[model samples]
Structures are given as C-alpha cells and as structure tokens.
Target: MELKPYRDNVGALLFNGAGLVLVARRADMPDAEGAAGGWQLPQGGVDPGEDLRAAVLRELAEEIGTDRAEIIAEHPEWLTYDFPPELAGRGFRIAQRYRGQRQRWFALRFTGRDADIRLDADSHPEFDAWRWAGIEELPALAVSFKRPIYEVLAQAFGPLARALASAAKSR
Candidate 1:
C-alpha cells in the first residue's frame, strides 16, 4: 500500500540531452495570469492508489507527452507551500479544499528529442506551450506561494544537473 501524503502533490523536473530543463508556458490561466504564464516543470497531484514516485513519472508523461525518461534522482524530502487566503478560495472549487500542498520532486533525464513532446496529449492540458529554461530561473517563474517549493527543487536538482552535465562530457 502507498503511504500517500495528505493533500500532497508529486511531480518531476525533466532535463533534456542538452542539459536544458523542460518548462511549460501555462497560457490562458486566469488566476496565475502573467506569473503562472511562464515556463514551469511538469507536476501533478498523487492519485488515490499511486505512489509518489509513480505519480511523478505519470505526470511527466501526461503533461509533456512522453513516457521514456530516466529518473536521475529525487529530493530526499518533500517540499511544501501555501496559497494566500484570497486566491486560495477563488478559481476552481478544489483549490480551497486545502491549506497547502507538499510536493515530492523528481529529476528526470529525457533521452528523447524535442519532437517527441506533446503537451496536449492528455484530456486536460496543464500547459499550452513548452520550452527549455535555465534551472536558475525557476524560482522567479513561480508565484509567491509556489516560490518556496521551486527554491527547494532548484537546490535539490542542482547537483543532479551538474552530474548530468559531467556525464555528458565523458560520452
């Protein structure tokens, strides 16, 4: 049985062969607006029967449109954040159901080329468009509520990114 985190989300941060991390541009978002409009890593909530790691792998495929990615590493702990009272109650009824969210972040190395991506493959698209972004710029793309989580992801994934880079040089 999976010991799921209460109201927690799981997601993966995928980096391509070129050492560039993948991010999706969430166009047409009302609440996120310009702040949420920037590039973002693939993420999703853990389903009822799914484990945290499984959830992330599933999210990566569903959000970005591919199932072939290597799990490089993951954060030792879960990262968390909360939305403000104002925005929390608005936009989509489910948003107000929780005080905050805890996320398990994964680092994945995508072996496939960019042509393999399909953001709208799922019934509901989380992002309309996608692009590769510098890992350093992630925190800035997130909203205030999600910034803390992004910071943690950036910190945890930094070493993995470096390792990925070094490994590429040897090939």
Candidate 2:
C-alpha cells in the first residue's frame, strides 16, 4: 500500500493558574469506531501558509472559546501519531485526507477565567464539555493513540505544571 502523508496540525496544552491542563470532550466523536467519548486537548489543522504560532492561537479560539492564553513553552520536536487502523479513512474532515496528524504542540497559560469559555463560540462546536485536569491525568483521559503524546507533554511541561500548582496552593 502507498504511504499517505500526515496532516499538519497544531495542539495546545492550556493550563490554568493552578496548573491543571484543559481538556474537552469531543462533540463529534465517531459513533462506531475509535475511542468512545474521551477527553482531549484543543487541536486543529494548520491552514496552508499559516504560521505555526498563529495556527496554535487560532485553533485554541476555534476549539475552545477564547484565545486568552500565553505561550509558556513549546515541545522541542514535532510529534506525530497515526489513527488506529479502524479509524483510517473514516471521512472525518480533519483526517479524511491523511493518515494522521503531525502536530506542533504548545504549552500555554490560560489567562481567562472559566466563565470565559464558550463551547458554542463557533457555529459548529467541537467540544460539548470542558474541564481542567492534572498533567498526569492527561494520558489516562486521552484516547489510546493520543496517550503517548500526552505522556510526553506531561514530562516536557512538568516543571511549569508543578510551579503553577504550587503557586495556586500558596494563594
């Protein structure tokens, strides 16, 4: 079989002041295959010719509600993941043309209050629910294919996550 290219995408790990990362429940989870109704960080495709940083911010606003987050750090390397065989060619708009995603991940500090989030901000919402979760909790909450990425993120951002959590507790 011919090898297919991966989709260029951007992912955000939005952390509150307390260090909990933001996760959203996919509103359009595939009904028959793939992980069923699990939480995931905000991510979307990078538009052709779009700058990576700009794409990250745009994806945050598009997937969540507000772009009230500041970049803390970025993963040093681009991360790629493939969809489960069962999910390949499922016609999902984001994955329809590719084997999976090649993502540039960002670590962002959310500057907005919880009230600032609006699942309905877009005409078609991607998430039905949102919550803040501890860094270690990410891997477990994520779908299987995404777990490895989350694990790497948890490690890559561990220091910042701990500091934020400590600061929040001190307040």
Quick one: best TM-score, which candidate? 2
Which window of ten consecutive residues has the lowest lDDT sum in model 2?
A: 87-96
lDDT tens readout by residue for model 2, 59-132: 98888889999998899899989877665445565555577889999999999999988889999998889999
What ranges in model 1 sit over 4 Å off?
1-6, 31-36
Collision count of model 1: 0
Candidate number achieving the greatest lDDT relative to the actual structure:
2
**Residue pairs in steric clash, candidate 2?**
none
Residue lDDT tens for model 1, 45-157: 88888887778878888888986788878788877766566654456333567666677888888988888899878887878888887777889987666887788878878
Q: Model 2 scores what on Cα lDDT?
A: 0.87
Instruction: List runs of model 2 lying over 4 Å from the truth.
Output: 30-36
